[model samples]
Every structure is written in C-alpha cells, then in structure tokens.
Target: MLTSGRKGLEASARGTTVLLAALVLASCASGEPEAKIEHLCNVADASEEEALLRGILRADDYTTDINNRTSRVVEGLERNLRDIGPAKETLSTSMCAYKPTPRAGSDRARFEFGWVPRTSKDAEPLLSGGGRFDANGAFGESNYFQTRLFVRCDMPGDLAEPSKAAWLYARASYSFNIGRTDIDQAAKDRQTALAYLMARRVTDALGCENKPLEKPPVVKPAPTP
Candidate 1:
C-alpha cells in the first residue's frame, strides 16, 4: 500500500510539471507576435521636434494616434497667424503612413502608398524626386506651410525574398490665417524637420537598408530663366 501511494504521488507531480510547461509554451506563443508588433510600431520618441512645434504654435499639449495596422497622426493647436485673439482648434503637425505587407510588385507597392502611374500627358510626379529622398511642399490658402516625404525600404524579415519591400510616407503641416501669399519660412522649416524625423523613426524600427536619411531632403527651387 505504501509503495502504491508513493507511485500515485509521483504520477501527480509529473502531470503538474507537464501542465506548467504547456502553459509556459502557450504564453510565449501568444506573446511573441504582439511583441513584434510593438517593436514594429514603436515611434513614441519625438520630444525635441514636438517641443519646437509646441513653442511655435503656443500649444500646451498635442494628441497622438498610433496603431498596429496603418498609420500615425499627431495634431495640435496654434494661434491664428492673422487673428491672435483666439487659437485655431486643430492643426495636423505630423502624419506617418506605413505599409507592412506590400503587394507583389513595385508598382503595386507604389499604388498602395497612394501613388499611381500617370496616364495623362500633363501629369507630374506627386513628389519632387531628388537626393536620397523624395519630397514636396506647398502653402495653403491660410498661408500655412506643409511638406511631405516618401521613402522605399527593404522589409525587415526574410532577406532571401528580396522582392519583399515596404514604404514609409510622412507629412507635416501648419495651419494659420495670414495676409502673406507665400509659405512661412520658419514654419516650413519646422514642418519639414518633423516630417523627416518621423520618417526616420519608421525606417529605424523596420531596420531598413537606406535608413538614417543622412541628408536633408530638398524641394527643388523654382526654375531660373
């Protein structure tokens, strides 16, 4: 009877050990994907540029939108360039659109990034292509400044599949009412800086080959006669 009881106790101990191991494996399996997603989407650190924007806009706080799927948008408030009496409600300071799983072809990837090949004779490039990056900008009716950047990068995993690629799109804008018809140089600089900063972060997270965005992107100056 004593030997039988000892045998039963050993069997119970073995079962409990097996159950614990299974639980641990289950936990790891469930957590691994989420951990990868978190790393993939991590871009929380933009404090210096955020502070610059806040100071320029005289805003106390800013709001952020981050998700595992598509994009991140951050908005803030600024004092109207024309009317200093009241603050304008919201201005989109930065936007970042990422494509994690690009389609099969390079053209498909560009289309996914919202650019399609131009079929018309008068069509123009969405972004002025130059340097190591592509960029463009314009002044709004309010005379505020806006700029955008585009970059193509190698996808993080499965280097064996060289065709796998990703794209990062970033934009920054300032909204204000002013009498001037041209873009505000100071505001333009700030917006461009922020857009580049956000794009750099995305590339860094993805471990892209063309990352670091070493040079400041340029918007070609108007033609000289």
Candidate 2:
C-alpha cells in the first residue's frame, strides 16, 4: 500500500503547479504590450548647439527676419490647405521644405531661405511644445530674465501638387523673475522650443505622418519638457 505521507506530498506539489499556471495566465492577460520608442535628438553633440545659435536667435532683428520669412511660408501653406479642401486624392504632407541660406561669417538671425514647393522630410524637430521659461537672472534682491523668440515650420506639400508647401509657426516674449543663479541658458532654449512645438502641432494636424495631432496641443508654456 502507498504511504499517506507520499500521497500528501504529491497533492501539495500538484496544487502549487496549478496555482503558478493560473498566475502566469492572469499576468499575461493583464500586462500591457511593450511600446516602440523613438529617440528624438541626441544631446551629446555640441555642434548642434552652434548650429542653433547660428540659425536661431531671439534678438529683434532675428525675430523680424524670421517673421518675414514666416509670412511667405504661411501664404503658401494656407493656399495648399484651401486647394486640398475635400480633395480625397491628395496624400498629406508632414514636414517643411526650404533651401537654407549658406552660413556666412556670423550674421544676425537675418538669414534667407529658398522655399521649396510641396516637400516632406522627417527632419528632427526642435520645436514641438509650449514655451517653457528656464533662464534666471539677478536684479539686486530679485532675479529676472528677458527672452524673445520666433519659430516657423513649413508644412509638407500636398501629394497632388509637387510645387506647394504649408506653414505653421509661433512667437514668444517673456520677462520673468526667478532670483536664482541656478537659472541657465535653458530659459532661452525653452522659448525657442515653444515656437517649434507650435509648428510641429500644425504639421501633425495635416494628417501626413499619421492622423493629425490633437487640436490645441500647445499654446502657453508647459513644464520643462
């Protein structure tokens, strides 16, 4: 005859295995699937910093210069939108296309671009969210900062029209107090980022990359982002 102890041990082992199997199945059902990750910009290269400083600046002269360019791009973009109204055959555009001016001996943000009609490139975006203030300065007992920014993006051209592109853009002015030396160059950078964010939101809305980005994605400043 089989011993009672042996039978008891066998029964416990069976119970444990059943419980483990149930737990595993439950976990699989409840777990979320892994998400695909995309790296936007690499922060290590200092060359990009120089490029940004050269191409992007917040001085009044640069602001005016950028705004002027923006106007031309916007005109083109608005026209494309109008033409594409209810046209089901046209494929959407997602990014801007313009021939950048050659970099010369350090010029003020006063640069010119040859706008290209209806183009799409998955260029890395520097702007895509609301303005975030980060620079801090000193004012005797208080700290403050003055910032100005202008940003613009040319929307991808209509797939139907190879000669057209759209535009989305933003501008920012900020003077604030943090009263801390801890404030850094990021303050200015955030303002710049705000402009790009506006443009990105607009491009995303064109339903080119995927479905259009959600409405009112960013207007005012959000967190450090």
Candidate 3:
C-alpha cells in the first residue's frame, strides 16, 4: 500500500507539470508574433553603416526625417504642377497636404505613433508600433525598430472623379526602427538598413518606379599586390 501511494503521488506531480507547461506555451502563442528582419549589409568600399544611417537621420531642422522626405516629394510635385499650363485648376487640392487622424485604440499613453500633421512633415509619423526583428547578433527594441507608412495618390481622373486633371497627387507616412545600440560600427549597420528602406520610400514617392535611384558606382578594390 505504501508503494502504491508513492507511485500515485509521483504520477500526479508529473501530470501537474505537464499541464503547467502547456499553459505557458498557450499563453505565449496567444500573444502577437514577432517578425524576423534581415541583417544590415555593407560592401568593402561602402561608407560605414553609421554614416549610412546618419544619412537618413531626421534633419536637425525637423524631428521627423520621413516627413521631410515626404515633404520634398510634395515640393517637387507642386513646383512642376504650378507650371503644367491649364491643367492646374482642375486639381482640387494639394495631395501633398494631409491632416492627421487619430488612432482608434486605448494604448495612447504608452505609445504615440499616430500623426495628425500640422505641417507637411507632420503628416506622417516614422517608425511607430513595435515589431520583432532577428538580425543575427542584432537586438531590436520595438520603439526603435518598427515603422509604418502610407502614401495616397489621387491621379485626378480616377473613377470617382473623372474631370480631366492627369497628374499625380500623393501623401505618404513611413516608420521603422533603428534598433538600440551605442557602438559606432553597429550603429552604421543599422543605419545602412534604414537608408535602404528610406531610399526606397523616397524613390517610390517620387514616382521613380521605372527608373530606380542610381546604383552606387562600383569601386574595384585596388589590385592585390
């Protein structure tokens, strides 16, 4: 009887352990999944990654770099449109002009990623909302590594309004995480990643689909002696 009681106790403990393990796993599964991101790349001759990232840094004059890039696109468009002869009047409003709309959720205090632009740069918030990244040895903080962006283009003669304006009107918001780090080399790696992303966004906003940004001029490493 004593032996039987001991065996029963052991079995019950094992069962409890399994149940607890399952619950923990289920809890994790219920939470949002983290995304995997690629590591940054650098060529032997390319500027160090930190420099690359800095290239994309928010202009000191403005807090949001993406917004500034977006504004540049808008400026170029408006400049061209102003000279487009008689088609200017048909366009209703500057598509580059955008107003901020609030996010519909209760987590406003912890996170403020949404943008209601007071100016062109304010229209879109860069890199909001946390995301998971798996970049080899790189660790990412949600606050630094996640980004969201949306650009709207109304080309005058769509189905909804078919008057006659045949120009592109666009608005865009972009966000991304630069990760958390202090090392200069590491910072460069992250910056390269951001520069690649930012360049793509700017090129797209500029309608450079067919003609992408010019490729970096290749430098043949000096002939090995």
- Candidate 2 lDDT score at position 109: 23
Clashes of each: 0, 13, 14
Who is ahead in lDDT, 1 or 2?
1
For residues 1-225, what per-residue lDDT tens digits would candidate 1 score against the true structure?
011122333556677677777777877888842222132222233565545444444444333223323222110111111111121112222322221122112110000111111122111233322112234432111114335454554444453133132123444433331233554555555555555655565555445665545455443433322
Off by over 4 Å in 3: 1-72, 77-182, 209-225
Candidate 1 regions exceeding 4 Å error are 1-46, 67-145, 155-168, 173-183, 212-225
Once model 3 is optimally superposed onto the true structure by TM-score, how far is the C-alpha of residue 94 displaced, in angstroms?
17
User: What 10-residue stretch in candidate 3 is worst by lDDT?
Assistant: 107-116
lDDT per model, in order?
A: 0.35, 0.32, 0.30
Q: Model 2, 1-225: lDDT tens per residue?
A: 111122333556677677777777776798944332122111122343234432343321111122323334444445555564322222222222111233223322221112222232211123323233311110001012332222223235454233234222222223222233544445445434433333343344433343232232222433442
Q: lDDT value for candidate 3?
A: 0.30
